[model samples]
Target: MVIKMRLGKTNLEVNKNGFGALPIQRRNMDDSVEILLHAYENGIDFYDTAHFYTDSEAKLGKAFEDVRENIYLASKGAAEEVDEFWKQLETSLKSMKTDYLDLYQFHNISFCPKGDDDLYKAMLEAKEEGLIKHIGITTHKITFAHEAIESGLYETLQYPFSYLSGKQEINLVNKCKEFDVGFIAMKAMGGGLITNSKASYAYMNQFDNVLPIWGIQKLEELNEFLSYDENTILNDELKKAITKDKKELGEDFCRGCGYCMPCPQDINISMCARMSLWIRRFPAEPYLTEEYLEIMENTNECIECYACVDNCPYELDIPRLLKENYEDYQNVLDGKTKV
Candidate 1:
């Protein structure tokens, strides 16, 4: 049987687990389409994409045309102004090959509540114009998410939710249920920190209102989630393994929210976190070269304003972690230890 769940306050039904199209954007068009088609054939009906994700809208548009009526398509726009918002909506419609989007979200509203209102009004206008079926918003900030739900201007709220989020974020899940707002979970795998797929699936399965969109690029990862629908349960041994992994991952640090982006210094905070894992855990000798050291050290330019730290879902010490990572990266560059 297909695993299905009800999106809050709407008649729409979707797969309890959905496919996130971010990672697949890194792959070639043919490969991405194949993976998306595989996900659809295996009972995934909810597809989340954004105009920001390079070529993701176009790929999903082409792959799902035959099955479009049977699926739910959610897309987001990063537009802040009225004209830009309208332009993005039009671009998304063209890219997705659909006249009406199942859900249209304001992407990553960090602090500007007033701006959110403007966007909400535009979405309402769009809905009136028959361009969107429902309105939604996505955010890395828990405070903004709470506000979105409380404002009742949105039908859904997408946020960074993984085993790594703190109590405040965990409570947001409950609040979504209380407010009858659909909770679409992003970064369910901790952006690759949660290596165990079974653990990730089991943790997400505990939430009834939340629908996790796993960024599946390969058939293997897609098949893994598909297996869960077929009755694959996490055993005692697997539970123990997950616990150990969580402990090692530590607590309260960088939810990979991508808030501190487009740094003036060109430092990639999100990729640095991922590469730090490679420098510490995996065989990343090649990445530890002088060129890579320059990239790691570039984070020193972070003015210590704690902008990223404050915006992080897990409330990580952004500057400190960046500095610590720099040191580790230096050691690896010097050949003191295997990266």
Candidate 2:
């Protein structure tokens, strides 16, 4: 089983594991360069970054300027207009020191681009200018993905997908396959909620149409994915792990996509909503320590305004879930349950 899959119509054949550069933005330049170079040298050829990721694209520029042609670089444009799109495209090209990108995506837009919009015309003009080889879209919205595939606009769709994601999300991957649209799986580790890499590998390996990009900021994380065999397969034990995760996680948990951010109450709804999983899945001390405890406690400020619920792609009952998780956290802290 060759672990490489050709990404839909663009036909960019990538390993099941691609490098996600969002976390790279948090690292200093030197450390970013080291990890990126290591990833490239070790057979990870697909690199995904975005203009909004702060220094991520710049670090990629420094690390791979000499050999940009050897890798598939995908970046996203957050611009909602024609002029801003061009500006962002130029910034990305200049940052990466590249003339064009293998794929340029509309970053998490609420609606699909259309011929009626200035952005669509700009996309065509950019493709004509050879500034972008392929146009794609990334969104947390499942309905928008269906619309994009139906419109036949995007060559690829990047979305949050992991072992914890349920049937509806998996259908998005399969729908992309049916429509010949590339499926790029983000949040493969469930936004750090899933601690098991081998299980992640086994789960993602089941879909040849889907290519998962692991967000790597540390050496250990990168090494975990890199250490897998080329013929990686999901064994019975891994299947059991997947089933157990789904049962415990249920349907209403946060995927941690951060779309419900900028809470008026200054709360971090993403992590706090999933606090139960973080406590159950990883080391207890790091999260239960004073700093994270403060962050989690801020959910007490939630006014139940439904702002987060509105933005959530899953339409989760966020305020209610936050309260539930907070109550659960208090239990573990009180020695009622072990982490």
- The predictions' CA RMSDs to the true structure, in order, are 2.5, 1.6
Reference-based lDDT, each prediction: 0.80, 0.89
The digit string of per-residue lDDT tens for model 2 on 100-126 reads 999999999767897677898898789
Best by the TM-score measure:
2
Residue lDDT tens for model 1, 273-323? 556676554557678577877777787777877766655655777778887
In Å, residue 61's CA in model 1 sits off its true spot by 0.7
TM of each candidate vs. truth: 0.90, 0.95
